[model samples]
Target: MTRTRFAPSPNGPLHLGHAYAAIVAHDLARARGGTFALRIEDIDGERSRPEYVAEFFADLAWLGLQWDGDPVFQSARLGSYVHPGERLKAMGLLYPCRCTRAEIAAAATLFGPDGPIYPGTCKHKQVDPEGAAWRLDVAAAVALSGPLEWVDEIAGSQRAMPEVFGDVVLLRKDLPASYHLAATLDDAADGVTLVTRGLDLFASSHVHRLLQALLDLPVPTWHHHALLVEPDGRKLAKRRGSPSLGDRRRGGEDGPALAAALRDGRLPAGISLSRSLHTGA
Candidate 1:
């Protein structure tokens, strides 16, 4: 059976862009007579809030999205990440890095999709594992996995290039697992067959694909839909003060009607859809 998931971080209220992604994942599962799942990605210890998590459920329900089974919270699954991380460490594919963000920025001359890529400053350094962030040796990992490719429902097939992002952090200094490690493990655990989200995350699939190969987990197809942007062409984001779904609900807007409007391309004033496929690094 085909299974899809809408994993959202409970760091803020859900906005229209989030609603669009949720609705797409939910409808895709329903249309295929498959299962739809929701996962709360609340691993950010500093920013995740209980109030935001409560609002996440309320917003999804208000938007007429009923997920199968209870939501899986990433916070409770920290232990599950250790085994995979250790396996990589045993294989000499993971290394402890002590570089701070400022240090990396000072050393890096080139930037990838996610800001300045790490210059592999600690790739060969012998750092204490405790309280240190772990980075995957992208070149070594790709060599082990060989040439790999994944398919996207919208953009078609893509060759996996994990090196584009440099050595990505698999485990954070402050958290047990990074987003790349946790999300990849959770998707496999939940049996998600179709990973649905916005196109801005399209490049992330390459890293996730490599993790799947390294961990010997089941691979899933991806569907990176276009992002919903403001009139200024910036993507809607909670940090940018984008209006939340709760704000709309409190203002008496019908949730189901708004979902239908989004599906039909009748976006609200000052909001438009950017359908371009972002495959660039």
Candidate 2:
């Protein structure tokens, strides 16, 4: 059976973008008669709140989305998250690096690959004196996954060689799983055959594919839908105080009107009116 998951971190309130994603996942599952799962990616215990988690469920319900099986919590699966990293470390595919955020930011400025590109200053250079974050060895990444191919349902098929990402973190020094590690473990464990999410995460796909290769997990299909953005054209973020389903519901706006507002370009890059009209029940 087809299986997919809508995994959201409980760092803040669920916004319109969250509904767009959840709606898409729910519709896809219903169309295919597959199972849709909900996963709470609350690994960042410092920021995630119980209230936010409760709000997420309430928001999804208000938006008419449902899931199969019990919701999975990444915070509770800490042990499972470390298993893959440990396997990689045992094979010498992971190394400990002691690098601070400031140091990484400095390297990112010098290197041209984007913010915090990780200059590999600690990659095989020297062992961290004390506790360190474990990074995947780039050599191992290339050796294991030569090249990756993914067919994004929205943006078309894309390919990337593992070398592009270099060494990535599997485990933080604090011993918490990074987003990449937790997502990889959960997707595989849930038997998700098709992975769908916003397009902003395009860059992270390489890391996920690499993890799949390293863990010998099934490489699922991908569908990267467009991201919802604010009126100012900036990407919508929970931190930016975007209007959410709860906000609309409280305002007494019905589902169709909310859908119309989203599709009428009140928000940027949301589903087009044509798509929304066709998708509505």
Candidate 3:
């Protein structure tokens, strides 16, 4: 059976942009007579809140999206994230990284899919692993994988080139797992066949593909859909304090009616396709 998932980090309220992504995933699964699942990416203890998790259910319920069973949360599955990182480490693909953000910015000379490619400052250093992040040797990983490829429903076949990302972090200093490690592992564990997410994260798929190969996980198809943006074409992100669905709900707006509007390509006055938004933002 086909399975598609909508994994949202419960750091803030669900906004119009989130609504679009969720609707897309839910509809895509239903179209194929498959199952739609919801996953809560609440691994970031600093930002994640229990109330936000409740709000997520409320927003999805308000959207009238029927998902499979209860939502799977990342916080509750920290143990699952460890084995994959350890596997990579056991293969000598991971090294301790004590380089701070400023240190990396000062050392990086080339730009990758996401910002300055991390210059391997700690790759050869004798950094203590006690409280340091674990960095993946991307080049070594690719060497082990021996050329890789994954497909996206919209963009078609993609040649995996995680080298551009330089040595990416697999384990964080404060946390047990990085976004790349936890997300990649969780998707495989949940048996997600189609990964549906925003266009901004499209580049991360390259790194994820490499991880999947290294960990011997099943490959899944991807759909990096266009995003909903503010009137000025700015990406509507929670970090920017984007307006939330709760605002609309509180205003007595009809959830299903709003969903219908979205389906008909009729978005609210201020929200539209992000013509100017970059994919790697």
Candidate 4:
């Protein structure tokens, strides 16, 4: 049986963008006669809130999306994230990073399409400061994985070479698993054959693909859908209130109304594509 998860970080309210992604995942599972699972990515204790977490479920259900199994919350699955981090560490693919935001900004030189890349300042140094971040040693990760490739439904065939993103961060200094670490592990563990997420996460796919290779896990097909944009084409986010699902809900908007608006391209005014994408890219 095919399995896919709609993992959302419950740091804020589910907006129109969230609804689009959920609908897409739920629709695909229905089409394939598979399972759609929900996972709460609440590892970031600083930002995650109990209220928001509760609201996330209400919002998805409001949008008429359903899951096959009980929703899994990452905050409760700390142990699950540890094994992968240790596995990569055991293989000597991970290293301690001590660069501060200021330090990284100061050192980064070559501005690539993805913005200023890591400059390898802490790559050679054993600078694991008291609260310093950690990065995967790209060279070691590549050696462990050999080479890699994966298929993306919308982005089509995708490939990554280690030279692109050197030693990425798997765990933060605060001991919480980073997004890449938790997502890759959970997808593989749940037997997710395909992943449907936003386009903004396109670059992060490289990091996740690398983790799959190192962990020897099955690589799921990815579909980086287009993001729901505001009238000015700005990405919808909690920081912007008008497009927020929470705001709309409080303003007397029901689930059916919201979902209909999204499906018919009526919600948020300028959102048109009936089958458009929901990626952050």
* Tens digits of per-residue lDDT for model 2, 1-281: 77888998888887778877877777777789899999998878589887788888877766667799899988788888766777887887887888887888877634322346677888867786367888888776767678667666665677754455567777887755787788977898889988988766666777788788778898888877766655454666778777766777767767655555554546534323222111100
Model 1 lDDT tens row, 203-234? 89999999999999999999899899998888
- Pairwise lDDT winner, candidates 1 and 2: 1
lDDT, model 4, position 190: 80
TM-score of 1: 0.98
What's the TM-score of every candidate structure?
0.98, 0.87, 0.96, 0.89
**lDDT of every predicted structure (CA atoms):** 0.92, 0.73, 0.86, 0.75
Clashing pairs in 3: none
Model 2 collision count: 0
lDDT of candidate 3? 0.86
- Best first by lDDT, ranked: 1, 3, 4, 2
lDDT of 4 by residue, 1-281 (tens): 66777888877788778888888788788889999999888878689887887788777876777788888888778888777777777777777888776777688876543556779887788674567777888877777677777778866776665455555677888765787788888888888888988776766777788888778788888877777776666667777774666667678777877787766667555754322433222
Clashes of 1: 0
Error of 3 at 212 (Å): 0.7
- Segments of candidate 3 deviating more than 4 angstroms: 275-281
